[model samples]
Target: MQKVTLRFSHNNPSCLPDYRNHSRSLKKVLQELNIPTWQRKRIPFLYYDDELVAAIGFFVCQAYVLQESEPSLHITWAS
Candidate 1:
C-alpha cells in the first residue's frame, strides 16, 4: 500500500531543495511570513513515502505538485 504522511519537525533545515529547484531557507521563509520564533517549530511538513513534499505554510516540493488534469490530494491546515 502507498503511504502518505504529514509530520511536524523543528529541525528541517533549508538544505532540502524546493519546488523552484533551489534551496530555500525555512528560517527566512518563516521570518518573511512574520511567524514568530516561538511558533516556527509548530509548522507541519508533508511527506510522501519519506520525501519531503511541503513545508505546510511555505512551499511544496516540485516532484509532488500536481499537473493540469492530474488527480491530487487537497490539504488544509487549521490552527
Candidate 2:
C-alpha cells in the first residue's frame, strides 16, 4: 500500500515547485484568483508519500499528473 496524505499549512508558496518545472509562488496564483489572505492557508495540499501532488483547487505537480490510461486517485475537495 502507498502512503498518501493531505495537509493544511501556512507554507511559503514560492518554495513549492510547479508542474512547469518552475518555482512559481502559489500566493501569486491565489491573489490572482482574489482569494482572501486569511483563507489562503486553509487550502489543502495533497501529497504522495513526501512529494507534493497537488494544491487542491489549484494545480497538480507535473510528475504526479495522470497519464492516458494510467491508474489514478480520485480526489474531491469539499468546502
Q: How many steric clashes between backbone atoms does each model show?
A: 0, 0
Model 2 TM-score relative to the real fold: 0.67
Worst 10 residues of 1 by lDDT: 10-19
* TM-score for each predicted model, relative to the true structure: 0.65, 0.67
| After superposition, candidate 2 runs with Cα above 4 Å error | 10-21, 25-34
lDDT per residue for candidate 1 within 1-79, as digits (tens), equals 7787877674555634353556666676567668888786777877767667787878776666679989876877888
lDDT of 2: 0.70
Name model 1 segments beyond 4 Å from true. Answer: 10-19, 24-36
**How much is 8 displaced in model 1, in angstroms?**
1.3
CA lDDT, every prediction? 0.69, 0.70
* Candidate 1 vs. true structure, TM-score: 0.65
